[model samples]
Target: MKRISSIFCVALIGCLLQGCEKKIDLELKTTTPIIVVDGRVTNSSSEGSVVALSYTKTVKSDNSIVPLTGATVTIQEGNGTVYSLPEVSNGVYRNASLTGIVGKTYHLTVVANGQTLTSSSTMPTMVAFDSLVAEDFPGFGKTIKVVTPFYNDPPGYGNQYNLSIIKNGKLIKDVFAYDDLFIDGKKATFPLIYSRKADEFKKGDLIEVVMNCIDHANYKYWFSFSQSSTGSPQAVPDNPISNINGRAIGVFGAVTFQKRSIVIQ
Candidate 1:
């Protein structure tokens, strides 16, 4: 019986050793997305003061931004001041319309699940608009190539234009669609980017763009209409776009897209 007991102990030790070796062979690590919070205090910001927060996307695929369902963001200012931002939407936080002054120091804190993070940037002297301009977006094998220069789009609040593409009063459909660009300079030309599309228009398609200013909120309303994929143009009927005349606090680069009808070599 004693000999049998010894054999049983040896079997148990062998099993324990094998389990330890398997665990030693296994290796694991993790990578967590970085969370970012940006706060801006502008002099003439319509909403007063606001905060925009974002998170890192998936490294391999373009569609991966983790949702901010239960994230909490808070801002604290100098002089022992603390403010709670309202979660306007998923991951978007807004602050009360407080006039932000120059030289005031502010900091932001973010907490999601158990992870915590922080970031801060002082508000620079505010810059106002000169006017938003739309010009021909060159490059990217656009319609008529570089020879056809895009002109300044007239000012309007919304996206409708009382304009015509006339080469000698003949209406031409040179305008393809809106395309935004991030120039090498890294500034978002921040314009309603557009360009002539290949095949959509002919060579030397003389096109003219015209529009008057509508409302400051026209772009947002029009975008929603576009997303619905409505075949018709009127996105928001109430904000009927009329005159296309206005200037911008700054210039905007136009957007462009490749005309599928025209094939490239």
Candidate 2:
């Protein structure tokens, strides 16, 4: 697996921007094909377990990314409840009824293109999101408005978090992971800074903030992604630390999330 791991170190532009457009140029000297696995299960009743499978693009490939099809995907609960996810489209598998439960662990298994990949994650209890406070920060010779969320961290060590900002229903493209290294069981607040200056919200815009209580493995994945997304030309890009065990690249996360919204003033 170590030899396979070194051949597919992807310098991801920004994992935070799931819906944003990106262009990657690979200069690696390898001919081995890679399988990418991305799976997630959330606590929301309206959400479901979604796993997307795809092949890594190479310099010899065309502009479009190729998806891996006809794969078997299954998720098992710690209590031995197994749910099969059917392919809904090209390479995406989903089971809408499989809502994640807090404190329960989940195992993901995927068999595709002659490779077997698996991972496990436990959903953490949600931390209450109290309020969204908008404030101004002096930067680049001007005052920039930003939204900060206030929450009380639960009284336990190793509480990690993944935050997402949505403006007028569209997701913001930036990394927002947090940990209780300094403020465990205490009041916590931080501004949701935008990577691009034009992404800042204006007055009258509707803003929604989501906080996902995640395990340490998922937290490290997001934190590593945040580091690799520096947008610096001089920085050599590498793949984020994945929880999945196999000859694959990506993550499988079981998370419980809470959300709050506010209208920019």
Candidate 3:
């Protein structure tokens, strides 16, 4: 989740800002390599689906990731339609014509190094927001404009949402997810959190907020990921609860998205 990444980035920036000259050596423990898969299928016909493959490294390594190549990846629809994704470059497997439809289940299969990994997710219905507005929040040294999106929760249980904020065509490093546990079948006004540098929106900047209707499994994946990544005291420092089987780390998400944009005034 973006929240987890944002927290890590803030901590790293703080350490750099401290201007410490002393180099501290840490005895990093070596661990076995695990396959990381970030695969997604959306309802947008113009957008292609991709499955990125890579191997994790130790903390003491040179911080370079080795891409997993020559792998076979395929996605199967619930109606028995299977599409194969070929390796293009940079360890990425993509299929340009495979578009997900709402209320349909999608299954992902990967074969690499004699190992097979698979996961399934169902695409939920798309929920469009009613409106979007920018609200000014007075801070210590600056005024921050937080984007607020308004939407009505559909009359049903098990509804989950994921908000993605884009500034000037670039996605911001902050994850926003919500569930209608208490406010089911009600109008919801969710405000975006802007606590870090990467989350701040400026005047005259183009901002787009994308709301995704995700299933319960995808919601749990992201919620647990955000908690574990942020080093929450309640959560143990381990890999987020993965939906993928066969020791792979990452998620296979099938989502429906509705987006709206506004230029900051």
Every candidate's lDDT: 0.34, 0.73, 0.73
lDDT of 3: 0.73
Each prediction's total of clashing residue pairs, residues at least 3 apart in sequence or on different chains, is 31, 0, 0
Span of ten consecutive residues with least summed lDDT in model 3: 18-27
Q: Output the number of the lDDT-best candidate.
A: 2
Candidate 3 displacement at residue 174 in angstroms: 1.2
Name model 3 segments beyond 4 Å from true. 1-30, 58-65, 138-142, 230-238
Which parts of model 2 are misplaced by more than 4 Å? 1-33, 58-65, 230-237
What is the lDDT ranking, best to worst? 2, 3, 1
TM-score of 2: 0.80
Where does candidate 1 stray beyond 4 Å? 1-33, 36-39, 52-57, 143-265
Q: Report how far residue 229 has shifted in candidate 3, in Å.
A: 3.8
Error of 3 at 192 (Å): 1.1
TM-score of each: 0.40, 0.80, 0.79
Angstrom error of the Cα, residue 239, model 2: value is 3.6
Give lDDT tens digits, candidate 1, residues 1-265. Answer: 2124223433444365443211111011213443333344433344445555444332222324444656676666655577777788876677656545554555556666676555333343222212323244444554222222223333321122112233334534322222111121122223232233432334544444332221212222232223332212311112221111121010111111111111111
